[model samples]
Target: MSWRIGDYLDQSDLDVIVVGIDCNEGLKRLDEYGPWKSNEMSDVFSAERQSIGGEGKEYVEFIVHELKSMIDEMYRTLPGETSMAGSSMGGLISTYAACVHPHAFKRVASISSAYWFNQKEIEELIKESDLSNIERFYMDIGTKENTESMTILHT
Candidate 1:
């Protein structure tokens, strides 16, 4: 999927960067379920399906590398000052990136993450991940919505 860098640079000196990773499998599932709007971003990245993998974890790893390179080249941001944020499946990848590549980003904001992917695999990874240098972490989920039903997991 295409990564949409939001207009956060104009509002903060914190160098907030938002990356959108399209999850085709997730989007197709959403289409058959409900809320077609959820698939909009995924649709934009459909043409890039060949660039992504079938495994969610592998896809997340690719996104982490892409984001790090993009930020370093485009904004020249220092690893210690970079922050990443995303919603839903994006949140899952955001958290995965921070946990796996803690030095690439200092802060992570995950909104309604899909943590249920691979069952206990994610939890095991997060538990074993070294996050001593993570400056900040933000996680939130809507009480009105059943995230599990939406294939989202909030940890």
Candidate 2:
């Protein structure tokens, strides 16, 4: 659910392995982790925004915890080296995961995140929390990002 993730990583010339996670249940996963469901930014993307993602933060956290532990055990990974990246709602959750579990994810990239889904709450969350262990963050959005959107992309 991204643009040339592998090719981009290869071009960067960084010796980092890419792990692509598919979001077949994209909206559901977003609601589980995104802590938002206003459906206010329905026009931001072309996908049918039938219903907003549900409030399922606990479920999302549990799943992420389990996945990280399993991946660590199953692979020869270095500590403080995990990263998560995605686009749209995928981007939103990557940011959330890093904020909530910084030790597990040292770097995060949120590409064109659908912050308009629940902008106020996320803004409050950012102000209210203290993030640690995160070494890098990358975020991007289009110049023409939904002029009608309340959470218009600034950059």
Candidate 3:
């Protein structure tokens, strides 16, 4: 997150309003169990009622456009300086937001993004997206993390 939402949200000239919706949980939410989870998986993963990080993209769009509009109307913001940041599922969505809606975000900080949720789908989306307006993007994960599963699938 950029900065906590409250009276201090717009206090600084370079301040950012870190916003988040009720995304319920993390690891499970982006993969199999979650709150803003998708109802169907991509063709690569079989079309089922499993959550596959699709809803995460939609949620980010809502925040980048609708929610940001509301915030700009209420705060003194530096136009074109908006950024999105999050950890885990939130991190995954933050990166997705920049990949799909580059114009809405100038920077993206995705800490430990769960790209393992739908590796093929997410990777394809990022590869197919227009990242011209995304000035910067940061993504990271622990070396000892669950990347083993993703690595196996790729093999």
Candidate with the greatest lDDT versus the true structure: 2
lDDT of 1 by residue, 30-100 (tens): 33222112322342347645322234445545556775677678874565677777776567666777877
Candidate 2: stretches off by over 4 Å: 8-13, 25-33, 39-51, 55-59, 146-155
Give the alpha-carbon lDDT of every model: 0.59, 0.68, 0.66
Worst 10 residues of 1 by lDDT: 31-40
- TM-score against truth, every candidate: 0.60, 0.72, 0.67
Q: With candidate 1 superimposed using the best TM-score fit, by how many Å does residue 114's alpha carbon deviate from the native?
A: 1.5
Pick out the ten consecutive residues of candidate 2 with the lowest summed lDDT.
146-155
**lDDT rank order:** 2, 3, 1
Candidate 3 wrongly placed segments (more than 4 Å) = 1-14, 26-28, 31-53, 144-155
**Candidate 3 weakest lDDT stretch, 10 residues:** 32-41
lDDT of 3 by residue, 1-155 (tens): 33355556556564455655655454345642212344333333454444444456456656867889998888888658888877766676777777777888899988887655555667887889989998888878887776665555555
Q: State the displacement of the C-alpha of residue 31, model 3, in Å, after optimal TM-score superposition.
A: 7.5
User: How would you encode candidate 2's per-residue C-alpha lDDT over 1-155 as one tens digit per residue?
Assistant: 45787778878977766656655474456556466666554554347665465553664575467766777787787756888887777777777677677777788899889776667877887776567678898999999776644535332
